[model samples]
Target: MHQVASQLPAEAVASQTRPLLVLENLGKRFGSLQALQDVSLDFRVGEVQCLLGENGAGKSTLCNLIFGVYRPDDGLMRFAGREWVPAGPAEALDSGIAMVHQHFSLVPRMTVVENLMLGQSRGLLQHRAFAAKIRSIAESFGFSLDPEAVVGELSVGERQRAEIVKCLMREPRLLVLDEPTAVLPPDEIGSLLDICRRVADSGRAVILVTHKLAEIAKVADRVAVLRGGRVVAKAEMATADMGALVRAMVGREVKSLDVALSESGAASAPPVSAGDAPRPRALVCDGITVKDRHDAVRLDNFTLEIRAGEIVGLAGVEGNGQSELGMVLAGLQRPAAGRFFIGETELTEAGPAAVTAAGGGIVPEDRHAVACVTAMSVAENMYLNKLDRFTRFGLLRRNALNQAARGLMQEFDVRAAGADVAFSGLSGGNQQKAVLARELTLDPLVALVAAQPTRGLDINAVEAVYRQIRAAARRGVGVLLISSELDELIAVADRIVVLYRGRLVGERPAEPGERAAIGALMSGHGL
Candidate 1:
């Protein structure tokens, strides 16, 4: 058990409305990397404070320090006008601080209520009473989660909601939410922002860690931007504005996505003509069916096609068979019925190796679990899909692998200490870049299934990924882009298709002002 001081220092009890939390010259280091340095910030009650940063800009480090997941190597943190030294998350929670991490920490095999009950009550817990309370919190937060639903059976978005509700059940004075909107639909995003504001209005504080600039103006009273292990900028939402935040985040003026896309004028493959040959279909699926653990039909006879040199967007609310569809396409999960093809060749009941062996690439949604081996070296993970090229007699050629990995890193701008650095050592953005570099460069790679490709990425990183996907399309690869962000689908995909309950319901052109219609189709309104 960890301990915290119960009383505030007499010298610091001067003001009644003091900051709820305060950090002064705090620092943390992970080996050679100074993850955070000389950071000073304040969190006041009755305000939604936003922490803005690039993927590797030490935002997570700061949060961990606050929640007692990690101790500061230097400086101090004062909570409620006291020198707070919470030795662990339990102590932090005891002091009225709760956290919703980016990655879910629920027990998958347990029911939602069961998962939340763990470490909550010291003695015997009345399941019914706890479930009723959970339901109340869920309703207040605009979330609908079945208390008895098993965590593993729920979709990614549903799991996220469960994780959030778990923290909210504590009713803490300070709440930390890390990229909570990454898996939520646009319609739900407004509701979530409202929740943040409501929490603040109740004389509590919310520290929202996010990269989306639009969100700052809506819910945030104050904003802080971090870069290179330091706070580069801080301002009230009304003062500095979005552009200033972006400039501070990336250290330069970045062109907005719309401006960049318009200037590029990226076009799809030319329409087939009477005298011209039909565009080649790079990937095709038909009559695909899938069932969940509870024998529930997730996808029913779902089918789609992607022609060479085209990017097709799959749009829907989260948990609507989007992740499952991507898994099926990547040959990760076997479909209950039907088959798919890559470039005219039938791919019946496949695995990752077989798909990649026959012209397929995949960017999985859960990068840590599916797309990467974090413990391995970055260079080794880069060649994960194509080991034969760097191996002879079942052994890797170290020199050649390093040389090639160096080239790919430079080409993709994968920042790291060295090619030998552990994949986990890199930031989230760099990890995604490394994965893309590996998958996109596969020879004869005609099709790609990118699931939630830019989720949780900063604006600059998102722009970079969009350009890379477009570049792959230009190289005659067909791409099925699965995304929850409607704007992303519209900007990146040439044709947008809707998915509802594992079925394709409708489609629309990737044109401006088409989100509402597509959103409706995704919600199954026209079914």
Candidate 2:
């Protein structure tokens, strides 16, 4: 990819690491779109090589080519110093290459064990024999998962772990992880990076595709950045900092959170002072309790309230019940004991439609799977949650549906060719924007529950999303932002609450120099 002329710099040439995989002038084309161009690189054994790029910058295309998801138009690949060619994913896996895509590939309706054994040539007896090996590999990577757990019943983070475990079961010499930490909390992210180091230290190569610039310094030994389907810069991590990586990917300098989101800016909140009249409560929860598929308590007597125009942030070490709480608010999970209300209207057992009718909205963590229908057009998905409005008796209103979609796309800055484009065709940022436009445009919306809304987004996309959330709060819509980024919580929220073992352990007002205290509370400190 920058800072070099025709070959690698002198410093990189000085390294003695052996290349496990080598690509020479790799190129791939999809119709008129040249998704990848002359992407020549080497992945070395016993090292973590990070691939940094903006969404749609050909990172996925290159990874797909490497893992046999797509055949390269022209190139030469040498794995272990031999010509490498694979017909399909199974061939790649059999040849010691495994990939965990950003979007999961597990069958949600089946248990983890069943999904893992779906395409195997072995019978049930042989498959059951590998269950112990799978569990052992999972535990070795610090992943705790039940082989018999239904994929649909697992949380987003749990599902991610299952997908990773599936790949590790193959014991590949080269492991590719695409945006693995996008849905993980901060602590879990650290652990995942550590596991990557372990993978490399054990004589394997890890190709990490991620949007986070900070992580490269933590785990990567070499870095390559992609821009507009071409490699712009490639260097040892010791020579590249976060700022350099950002400049390489975007070709511009980006501002930090402190400099960009000032106390008096649009992302700011007014001080909590004595008011003239009491503001109306938009969202309230009383003694909510939830359990997992195995009947383990997830949320225990979680009581909270958010007044109109206020933003409350939910912070926790992941799996302490943040996902469960968000589900209860979204009407997807019925709490064991609780009464959730929107403006004094209790909706304890209401479905998603009823909750929407009661002035509530949610941006789920897994947007591709749970939030939007991937096969439908953008116009259809924008109104899929409220199709009744676009239908008259048994007749469909196509014109009206397309018109509404066009309006929302323009108003919310959704980058797409047209309303008829497939929802899955848009980039990750545009997809999230469309989901936001659909959920936040309810006529009488008073509350919004957004879970990890900025995860996996580039810097510009993150800024756009932060502005939208703050704008919603300014419009008197009570907002509950559940995220694992402490700096993000402090930046966008007015108050931050900690959840530990499915209960509120403590809370602190969003203030200067409070990260350490909040982190302590997350670890179950100070009672």
Candidate 3:
């Protein structure tokens, strides 16, 4: 591993309290991209320090460097008055530092206790004692997880609890959490924040990486905003607010969802009439019931409709049948009992190809897995759904494909080195943009189903996506937008529908001050 002596200036090191962890002038490079440059920070014991940034602003890179996932190219690190350079994650853990990544690392086939004890120098049957100890610690943090339950059988929230339990079992001095609350419900988010607070209060330092500005107030003692591989701003939570953070991160002002929506006047539009001749039903589902591969009910009698020239937002917590509903609408999965319609034509069991032929577009939740091919070029992936249009006589036309891809890339502002670059080389926001450019550019589109459309995007990219979705509605294409963010639904949707446990429980016009009511319904309370 790369190692260097202390290059941090004495004044910078002396300006803070005795720090448990210190990083000075840290730098990392991935091929041509400098993921981190001259980054410096100090972490004190018994405090929560939040790392705030856009998707590609190098927050994860810093955490990975500290945790021994990547060796820094420059700078030095000191921990507890000693130079600290861990060769790997095992050494980092041995030095009392543990990490809970966004994606959990537990073995799915193992039980909770078994997974936790995998790396420990203990026999297989010795997990019972460990399980009892973990159960007590988990209860103290108010997380209810069965020690004997298989990891695969737990819910997302439960799995997070198990991950945290695994971390605490090691009794680490410094804990790092990356976007821990991204998939959690509002109630679970409160619990997770409470857990973080307790961990910090017990003399352990916590580093939280997140994009949600609102979460900073709940647990952050200090906040650092990163932009363009630099720490643009840092402040104590007592004096910092959302506006200041947004300005520092993006170098400009940004309006909140409510304020932006109010200025746009989208919520004041008149409701669509069912009998309108010009705007007919573009997508319709009648009493759809679906089950997953494990024979669990995902959608129970779910029904909805979106007419042309309208944007309907589906709001719900993650894993509450949103994925199943999107799959059903995209014709990727066959509903057990339901009749789907695309502009008055019933399509009960049509596959993705048939749906695409009928003017349907899809932006899947897991974009890399379901939407794009990583090994393919950007130009090839752009025309994935409509290959025949660019092909003739069983021969490929590279020039035509590249030309069309370049035009759409320019139109959508897809930042890439070139059309022939690998699709995996693009950033997360640019990948989403490429998907949007391909779908929205399709002619005669009847319905567009977008799942988690703005996930992992920066604020600017999010604004671009909202504009494109609205523009598609104005172009006489029905749009079904599924998102976990209630504020996003309130901002861009003409009408919002709440889904709970595979059922549509509430529907309301996307008006101001409706978030509270919608949030209640999402948690199984009455509207």
Model 2 misplaced stretches (Cα beyond 4 Å): 1-18, 24-34, 73-85, 122-129, 386-418
Worst 10 residues of 2 by lDDT: 1-10
Which tens-of-lDDT digit does each residue in 140-253 have in candidate 2?
766678888889877788888888888877778999998888877676677788878877766778999988877888999999999878899998987776777889887888
Each model's total of backbone clashes:
0, 5, 0
TM-score of every candidate relative to the true structure: 0.92, 0.89, 0.83
Q: Against the true structure, what is every candidate's RMSD?
A: 4.5, 4.9, 6.0
Q: Which stretches of candidate 1 lie over 4 Å from their true place?
A: 1-16, 262-274, 392-403
Distance from true position, residue 408, model 2, in Å?
4.1
Best by TM-score: 1
Residue 321 in model 2: lDDT: 89
Ranking by TM-score: 1, 2, 3
**Global lDDT scores for all candidate models:** 0.84, 0.82, 0.80
Q: Please give the lDDT score at residue 87 for candidate 2.
A: 93
Model 2 alpha-carbon miss at residue 275, Å: 3.3
Candidate 3 — number of clashing residue pairs?
A: 0
Q: Which candidate is the best by lDDT?
A: 1
